[model samples]
Target: MSSKVIHAIYTDDDLLMQAVKQTREANYHIEEVYTPFPVHGLDKAMGLAPTRLAITSFLYGLVGLSVAISMMNFIMIQDWPQDIGGKPSFSFLENLPAFVPIMFELTVFFAAHLMVITFYMRSKLWPFKQAENPDVRTTDDHFLMEVSVGKHNVKDMSKFLSDTGALEVNLINK
Candidate 1:
């Protein structure tokens, strides 16, 4: 469904940041902000919750570690029973030195790959996905902030945004 939103454009990141804070203080609902580069503290200013990707990365690493241990135990201790070097004992701990490299590699591999996959999925940007950016200038040197206009006067919001250092404010329905 389409909704009415206000697109506030700013030439500088500092101006955009200040506009966001003022908009929030005035109890305006911000839809989104688009910028050419990452803005430090923007998420916090936008009141976004802390990300949980670190927890997922740790869990993925644990999974990789478990798989590595299980595979090494079955291969060298149970399935094939390799006798490389003088250590012919059928124990995983005894043959752990030989499997350390594999364990470390797998742990890092799983964490990196799964974290990337999780990021892409959570962002709703799967393969060949396209996002509808409201303003083209935002991809260059400009920053764009979208604010919802539900139950609020569009003209007043536009004026308020313009007064808060917005270079331009346009009403868009999307």
Candidate 2:
């Protein structure tokens, strides 16, 4: 069966939370939620899982730091040792402080790049994907709740939404 989406627009946070509670009470499955800005406790209210991006970013940053250290150590010590002002250059232990800048830069660089890419991929926000929003107002000043429903329950869901203070509601067929 094809999935049909019902989009509910809300202007009031309390009303929106109530609607979400009611939807859960009715056993409706929420597809996604959109808000112009973050709402406190919204994720828990929607029963969404905590994101794992932070851990992934940390791991990637560690890998980048290790690579930077090894590369810098090998190049500056073993491959080509350059003496400036009669300073000794050997392994990383000899000049550990000198590599701090490169290590920090690489760590931040990898964390930022990999975290962003991971978030984009996890959210399925690749290029050329058409906007899933049914209403443009939701992107600016409104909160949107997308729910998948059966054809038979469309009217009932719409009525519930209207009763629960939805500013607007639309049904999209997949």
Candidate 3:
């Protein structure tokens, strides 16, 4: 059986938000929403779970810190044992202050770069990836809301979207 979906387009973000709320209230299953830019509170409005990127970033930072510490201990205290500014060359504890800047920079670098990579991977965004958006206008100024039509009437769904301030509504068979 072919799947049917309704695409509701809105010109303004506010209208899109209201339409989403109205659609949910009317018991329509919203498949997705596409916007030109990030919309504040859109996830909450859509009842999506909070992201865990911050926790992953912290873990990446910890890994970076551990690598920095191990690398510094091996290079400075164990392998080469450089004597700079009359500081102790054989003890990592005594020379930790000198490694603080490197540790901090590496931690920040890992957190930032790894977080970006994780986001890209999680979002399925990669070089030369084809766009999945159904409407190209959604990448510009339009906001598109997709509603799944399992057993709902198509005309009723279109009217509901129009009533909720949709600029245009189209039905698609997928």
Question: Among these predicted structures, which one has the highest lDDT?
Answer: 3
Candidate 1 structure quality by residue, lDDT tens digits, 1-174: 788999999999988888889999999999899999999999989888999999999999999999898988887788888666777948888778889999999999999999999998999987877867877888899999999999999999999999998889899887
Candidate lDDT scores, in order, read 0.91, 0.86, 0.92
Summarize candidate 2's per-residue lDDT along 1-174 as a digit string, tens digits: 567889899997778888888887888888888887788888888888998888999999998899898889789998998885787786568788888999999999989998999999998999999987767887788989998886447889899888878998898877
RMSD of each: 1.2, 2.0, 1.1
Cα error, residue 118 of model 2, in Å, equals: 1.6
TM-score, every prediction: 0.95, 0.88, 0.95
Report the lDDT of model 3 for residue 18: 84
Once all C-alphas are superposed, what RMSD does model 2 give against the true structure? 2.0
Per-candidate clashes, comma-separated: 0, 0, 0
